[model samples]
Target chain A: MFGLIGKMRAARGQRDAVIDVLRETTGALPGCLSYIVATDPADADAIWVTEVWTDQASHKASLQLPQVQAAIAKARPFIAGFEFQVETHPVGGVGLPASEKS
Target chain B: MFGLIGKMRAARGQRDAVIDVLRETTGALPGCLSYIVATDPADADAIWVTEVWTDQASHKASLQLPQVQAAIAKARPFIAGFEFQVETHPVGGVGLPASEKS
Candidate 1:
């Protein structure tokens, strides 16, 4: 599994825009299994995105894409500082099965 | 997939213990696919746990297990307030595949 964790701070009125960008872009990614956007319920300015990509290559490919860069650029001014971490988890090491019913 | 997200506060001296409990207990769970414990690089008191379980049942089982409960009980004193979110992701909805070569 490829995991990414990012933190961003939204500008006064850009919170909705940032969320919309995240929803549209990540939701359409081909290699995405799941992309979770979490916000500090108490602080609308703080946001974190958690994404699982099919592979590092796909994630890397995403980074090189213009749309992704544009999204980042758009959000940069609103963001305080964001760090992204890409990690690979061991397979069959006790992960939930894809077909698990519940 | 079964995912768990938790936030915990660590006492001044309990950082290592919290990490140890996470490493040892989660590493031993039969249904654990991956259990990630992340700390704010700048703040020793803040911690986040992201776990993927084999299934919802397995995750629930983990919660009911004595060791798991005990671990939480031990950490509760130091935690300000922790909330756990259990979410199920839509499988094959563009998630990273388990056997991804990269």
Candidate 2:
């Protein structure tokens, strides 16, 4: 499986708005096993996003989806920067579909 | 929910060994909804661990578990460094238990 872990910083005082856009736009994407958005404890303006997909191709394709594009557009103004964008190969784990377990 | 996202760098040529230790140790912990270990694609010696727990207390308590301690000890020799240890409050996501969904 493909995984992505990244941190995103929102513009000053716009963290909640960025999160709202993310929450509304994410869900039920094809080949997505998990997509979690979280609030950073140390940095109020930072958010972390963790995602698992069936494959790298699936993850790439999802970005081209209309909903995702719209969400990016909607959130662009509030997005300050992105950091620690690491891609990963998930071997196995809880919460993943049984088929994904090694 | 509580979430943790971190990067762990293993000693040279020990990434797989570290991953094995983590995979063996993580599972069925109390209040743990998800614990995923993935290999970093860009760095052979780096691994990314993403975790979700029912609450902050559960995550803290998990460190005291015998299995967790054992795993930490076993993995320590190969662990070179840790980075980007970010704590988060999970709002909602797919693959999380239905009850955890906001």
Index of the highest-DockQ prediction: 2
- Give Cα distance to truth, residue A39, candidate 1, Å: 14
Return the clash pairs for model 1, or none: A32-B94, A32-B95, A33-B94, A33-B95, A94-B32, A94-B33, A95-B33, A96-B54
lDDT of each residue in B20-41, candidate 1, tens digit only: 6665556567566555565555
The candidate 2 chain B region of ten consecutive residues with least summed lDDT is B83-92
DockQ for candidate 2: 0.80
DockQ, per-model, please? 0.14, 0.80
Local distance difference test values of all predictions, in order? 0.57, 0.89
Q: RMSD in angstroms, all models?
A: 8.4, 1.5
Local distance difference test, candidate 2: 0.89
Candidate 2: list runs displaced more than 4 Å: none
Q: Is the docking of candidate 1 incorrect, acceptable, medium or high quality?
A: incorrect
Report the C-alpha lDDT of model 2 over A69-98, residue by residue, as the tens digit.
999999999999997687889887778878
Predicted structure with the largest lDDT when compared to the true one: 2
Q: Which lDDT tens digits does candidate 1 get at residues A27-75?
A: 4665655555655555566555656555667878887788888877876
TM-score of each: 0.48, 0.93
Worst 10 residues of 1 chain B by lDDT: B88-97
